[model samples]
Target: MAESANPIPRKAAPVRTKIDHLRLDVVGPVATLTLNRPERHNALSLDMYHQIPEMLSRLEIDRTVSSLVIRGCGLRAFSAGADITEFTTVRAGAEGARLYNLAVAEAERAISNFHAPTIAMVHGFCIGGGCGLALSCDLRLADTAAAFGITPARLGFAYSLESTKRLMDLAGPAEASYLLFSGRRVSAERALWNGLVNEVHPPEELEKVTYELAVEISKRAPMSLRATKEIIGLVRAGQVRDDDYTTALRNDLFESSDYIEGVEAFLGKRPPHFSGC
Candidate 1:
């Protein structure tokens, strides 16, 4: 048979980069981020530390996104914490460890400082840095199968003050101490009781429940949500002083379109269509 000429053209391949290690997806007013390293149970890699903050920066300016969700690739873990294999290589010496820790700190700060509300959708093992990630979010929603623990004691490392304070804020000093001291995984029931998680669902219900919650949050008045988040942060840090910045934000609420719409909708006996002004 004679050779036939090929007619179909192949599509161009997408450009790729190191940050592809993290998957970022935005749908409507919500963004979902998946830590793409599943073979290591979604261990937070070195690239991820830099990538997380960069991605968060993008979302910070994205007005369309009202919320963000961070999760691992599979049901096995939200994350297994940092990539331990790198410790023997890149993070070998004290200086390396310090640098690595700094990267991790910046990543956590990015998440915690995100302008919009964030949620930790936890399933399976959320340990060490993973635990820190979950704690950074405004809320934690998990499957009953999920477990959480801070394993710095197990790794022969002391936990950072900010991380410890977050644990203390949520689980109380006693519970936080117990976890850090023991490095034992806490069951979902225990985590929930300790206030480590907001809600626990069956495995099948976890995603459905989490997305529903995110959707509900996204529909609310954006400025109100942002103000509430800031207020909560001030309360947490005990920085409730009415400085000029704080005073300005408080005043802006009165001028916001959302406030006017809310009032009109209430008086008109209709659902408020807040423009998130």
Candidate 2:
């Protein structure tokens, strides 16, 4: 795989954490968050939802991490969705459902609002809540064997509006309706057609491809990435024209040190060392 323009070598060992059914591995500038319960197809337990926000909050302030990749530990699935075994206890009643729903919303919100870009590297089954998780990411890269679906219809419950909007935004209402209404899994190729995934690679190449993309993105000016993400979100929220804030943001970027460096690097025919100023 190709390295970043301003390459940061791999660490002697990746900084890793093993807790809460999630594993975090931080290399030089890309962090990978793995859903770790492969025994259950990495089914998300209730506590995993609570842990996500907390984990992301830490990463949000860590300047060392410029990009994040989310995936499952094993090849069987990205996730099988929320742990059904917990439904009897964690999502049993109205209040239980409410709390569970709140946690899911918070976790997804954290991902959507994360400072750095997020990529979902999907393989095998990405269903129900798992599909929502992938949609929350800024990008989704999947292997050919990956399958995606929004399956609330099968569960006899309504999907959250926030999650529904995300699906609608990416795949549009018609395709989103098909997934939600039929609860049928789509092949990775179909997912690509629906705009659910950015790319689909052979299973053997997915990891190398995903990390290569993440590393390439990490080498860019951080300020540009952050601003662009925010601006895109604004556009998604119906801000079609530039407002005062957008105008100011654009003006500031032009005056930034990284912008000057980029220009100079182009003239010098050398890679820019972006300090993210």
Global Cα RMSD, each model: 7.7, 3.2
- Candidate 1, run of 10 with poorest lDDT: 1-10
State the lDDT of candidate 1 residue by residue for 175-263, as single tens digits: 99999999999999999999999999987678777888887888789999999899888889978578887889889999999999988
| lDDT of model 1, residue 271 | 85
- List candidate 1 stretches off by more than 4 Å: 1-18, 240-244
Residue-level lDDT of model 2, residues 44-68, one tens digit each, is 9889999988888878878878899
Count of backbone collisions within predicted model 2: 0
Report backbone clashes per prediction.
Answer: 0, 0
lDDT of each: 0.84, 0.89
Model 1 / residue 126 / CA error / Å: 0.3
The superposed Cα distance between candidate 1 and the true structure at residue 60, in angstroms, equals 1.4
Relative to the true structure, candidate 2 reaches a TM of: 0.95
